[model samples]
Target chain A: MSRTSSDAVVVHQREPFLRGFGSFVADVWAARTMLVSFVRKDLMIRYRGSALGIAWTMVKPLVQLLVFSLVMGYFLGFGDQIPAFGFYMFTGLMLFGLFADQLTGGATSVLWGAPVVKKVAFRRELLPLAAVGGALVNFTFMGVVLLLAYVVTRDFPNWHMLGLAVPALLITVLFGAAGAMLVSALNVYARDVQFLIDVGLLLMFWLTPVLYPWSTVQNTLAENGAPSWAFELYMLNPMANAVVAFQQALWPGVDEAVANAAAQRAAGEPFIADFDYFDSAFATRLWLMVLAGAVCLWFAQRVFARLQTGFATEL
Target chain B: MAADVLEPGVAVSVEGVTQEFSLRHEKTLKGLLVSRLRGRHPVAERFRALDGVSLQVPTGSTMGLIGHNGSGKSTLLKIIGGVLTPTAGQVRRRGSLAALLELGAGFHADLSGRENVLLNAELLGLSRREIAARFDDIVEFSGVEQFIDTPMKFYSSGMFVRLGFAVAIHAEPDVLLVDEVLAVGDEQFQAKCLGVIRRFQQEGRTIVLVTHNMGDIEAFCDEVTLLHHGVVRAQGTPRTVVAAFRGLLAEDERERRAQSAGGRDDPEDPDLGFVRVARVVVRAGSGRPLDAFVAGDSLVVEATFHAERPAPRFVGTLDLYEGGTLLHSTSTARLGVPVGPLEGEVTYRFTLPDVPLGGGRYRIAVGAAPDTGSPPWHQVGDAAEVMVALRAESSGPFALGVTVDRPTRV
Candidate 1:
């Protein structure tokens, strides 16, 4: 490690490729205080003048969960077959909220921090990373809400739940951070990337099976004699596996028979009779998604390091 | 020449730094795509804002960067401050660095003054504990203690600059780069800011300043660099650099006036059939043409006019100017000098008993008008030049002698 000296500061033309990436991360680590301060400022300014203040962080996710459950359970009438249907939906919705917040926030971080990016000399990666950090703070609040919903519905979590939930949340945050870095770097030169992300997020939401159970999609594919590759491709979306992991972790004892019968009547089809979320097959897929998330993060960091050299001029 | 040596104690060294900016004709993706379809390049031009500029600053020395607008002084400063990366070469500095490149450059308008101070200090590389320790002193120095909690958006622009300057200086940087931000706030605060800068110099810190005020450069800088067209035209002591800058300005002004006179004319305003100023001259009392003089020397200005048409009366005015600023104007009517009816060519001379001016270069503006309260028939700016040697140090537009008497007992 190179020791920092107050007596000397050397500035040179930025190098490209791997050498630049290494120094960029080192610079960010040295300015960790700035990153932390930016995250705090982002969080504070977000709820500064509102009456409910930070409570909105929880209230927003809670209200969305309530509306989705009530409409699907009462108005659309899928409540009877599935035990603890609200808890089931809440788990997926909270996780999706965390992912969506980071996706949009990180993508716009550079444009939003134009003032500092154009004027100050620091690691520009901190801007998008801070956005991810801010989203994580909000996600933590929603996590508390998710636990409360499980408790109120009489779905007590066990040790296996803790083991899955920790890794699930970590993978989701990692994936979101990676996605944020990629989009934010592109958005600096082409602002159309920001709007493209909004459309992408909407499309990914339905694909990820956040509101509907993954078994329903699986049953539809099986009954139609669809190609096995269809099911495989659907699971390839990291968020799809993330949502399932979160659901299995939060909704313990998910009464397989009742859920299959409810899913059948709701969609007028035969749902999968035996679905094991904690089976080795599902765990391997979850771990694969975690690996994919790490790869994405590494790629994003490299792209961010390369793109940031022009940020001062572009902004 | 002596200051050009690079010693081991050099605080900042800039070597062959070149900066180029692409001037894109299209800023949006749609415009860029349209241009591509039309087979037009997106970059309309490439501007070299800095061209192989090199300089070395010794430890504890103050360097002033003086240039006209778009001369690359600010760009050099930004490169040295690390806010910009040159396309070629590099800048190496020894010591902790802080730059006030632009006043309130990093401040968040929605954040309070106190929050902004903490945020800016940390961005400038101060630790949280350091900011906490110096928080009170920063606020006191800024003189915004009463409104410290108010959001910066509500504060006056002067307050914003004051708080920014305070936090920057309090960071205790070993090398400071300042742009022309000191031209803010009241005169008293500006003086206080200069005092702090002087104290920084006394403490053996390196300072790089960019300002248009020649007086500041003369007073503060140990050495000065004059840039023109993205290149260093002169660099040395303040006097030599300032003189070169003034020469550049005079040449630019002369070229501008000649270009305007050559091709531009107000066609709607026909030439009035009256006397017009033809030539102007300045001479010493000893009957010799003079371009330079000392204070308290007798001087005379002679103006010759040609009357294209007969006029009942005419008045010619000789105006003295320093740069673009008009200093003194004496008209035949105002000075109570007699002017007979004008016909053909005529000459008039105005005399000053003593040239009540200080050191510096100046120009003359001559105008001839009919006594009919109409606009001047012809006016020629930059009619002549005068250089006055400094006799005693003084401020303001001109020099004045003064004396002081001391009482035996107080």
Candidate 2:
């Protein structure tokens, strides 16, 4: 028998919450420490063993840019048409890599952490969040590389570009967290997801404007005398909005330090306006990202919390 | 309960909790499809794994959870450790909790042993600085310092357990849970664990240990909770609960022997059944069945079997086991048993004269079949009862005839 000491705290579950949103807030707040600790562990463990160690965290994107610049820039001759075209391609690949890593890793967190779920009880969503958290470290590194590229080629640093990266990333994090929640939960019911994710990622890769820029697509559309309303269909691809923001953040442009040089190609202007191009697109991409990000985060957390309560039994 | 008694520092309290899990009827692919089509949710097939289990332990008590596999001992421990939530009921606790349910559950195979230790410590809620402080202790305690730099994939299972156990116990939870016995890998490691446990107990930390070994129950636990079939069968001092636990095992052994009753040829005469053995209980020949044995006392191995009808020279097999290992086997046919009727239960008691086995739990099985010519592999009467006993001052390796031989001192 136990005596109720002052330190003996009990978890009180009341009859009902005011509504749906209240419990979500409570669950997240209660589980916040677990989330932070879990995420930190993920990031640390990923970079623990390499010879280059944490430096490799930044090198993957740098190497990807170099490889892409050499092959695409030299052979394809696409650089002649666009300003510092190699930077544009590398920027696209970097963003795509981050998105791909997050979705794929987040989706598999539940399956991979099945042992922890079945054997021990903790907040289950952290498993996936941890996975995405690992990806975010990589994204952070990639973001630095983007800034470095600006230092190397641009006239001066435009810190305003931080706007596009920060909010756009918040949007991406929500989508990733949601995807992890859904995937991890689904993994419990059917194992087919373990393999299907790779194929799905491959398809989404081609669907996003990762290796190619949207400007080229819009240029083709300009021949039709108007921006391609058709190119707007691509934004429906979910992660496309994040890619748009990345292009806007890392676009090759000169600032006040080199305005004379910038005017060699109308540096003050970003891109010729067209609803089809990412930079000149409709105002909805930002809001679309916000709405999708919030919905996905809310939905994913709720699903993970509800589903994990049963995971020990089901597993 | 007194108000001051219920004040701060009570480690854990559990009340009226029940947990159920389903055993799917058919493991077949078609069976899965059919079950899904029938709209039979998992609820239709689930079994209650734990039923209305309640427990409480003070802040500084080392408690043992004793039960057979599937008896819900581990399940209850998991719930108490906060690794699992009860489907019904509630648990309350004070202070932080650390559980070693599965040692090394998070260790990655590709990582070096050193890296894994740090990673596992962090996983168990220790910070980097704390891990750094205890890193050497962990390595030395595990006795894997030589292989610390090597990948874990290269380490032996014993090495793996060492690393896991060292990292876990060092983290030092206010409340700790241990599952299964520690005798599987090595003698040296087991000794170290026992030492660790004893120290932990003296410190008055709350620890819940789940093991089938009664020795661990008697040695470490001040109290024990006997779980049976997803329920708390008994709860009391280690001695009392252990008695009840043994009683439950005896009942199960008898039931098994009863089902294997009639002879193979004749299924009609339920009463006059096969000479399949009924039970194997140990006695000191003192009329009363002692729970443990003196190191050099006579151990009487009693085997009871049934005889359905009269038969020719048939062999009866008896195998003695300690901690699930067969120590010795003997057949009655070897002693020239010609013919006997398989009509009623017969008891064969073998006097060991001196208990040679070391400290551990043991079970015996007896069965009657045919001749043992080819490999002595046939068995008919296949029933047994588990025996939990401790050997006093017994040493290792096949009845050495002495505890330890000391060299002559000049």
Residue range B258-279, candidate 1, lDDT tens digits: 4554321211123434677777
Which residue pairs in candidate 1 collide?
Answer: A7-B95, A8-B95
- TM-score winner among the candidates? 1
Tens-digit per-residue lDDT, A195-247, candidate 1: 88999998998898766767667778988999978988898888888887887
**Per-residue lDDT over B335-362 for candidate 2, one digit per residue giving the tens place of the 0 to 100 score:** 5665444445567766666655555545
Residue B273 local lDDT, model 1: 44
- In candidate 1, stretches whose alpha carbon ends up further than 4 angstroms from where it belongs are A1-7, A75-78, A255-269, A278-281, B1-7, B25-28, B263-410
Error of 1 at B195 (Å): 0.6
Candidate 2: residue B159 lDDT (0-100): 83
How many Å off is the CA of B120 in candidate 2?
A: 2.5
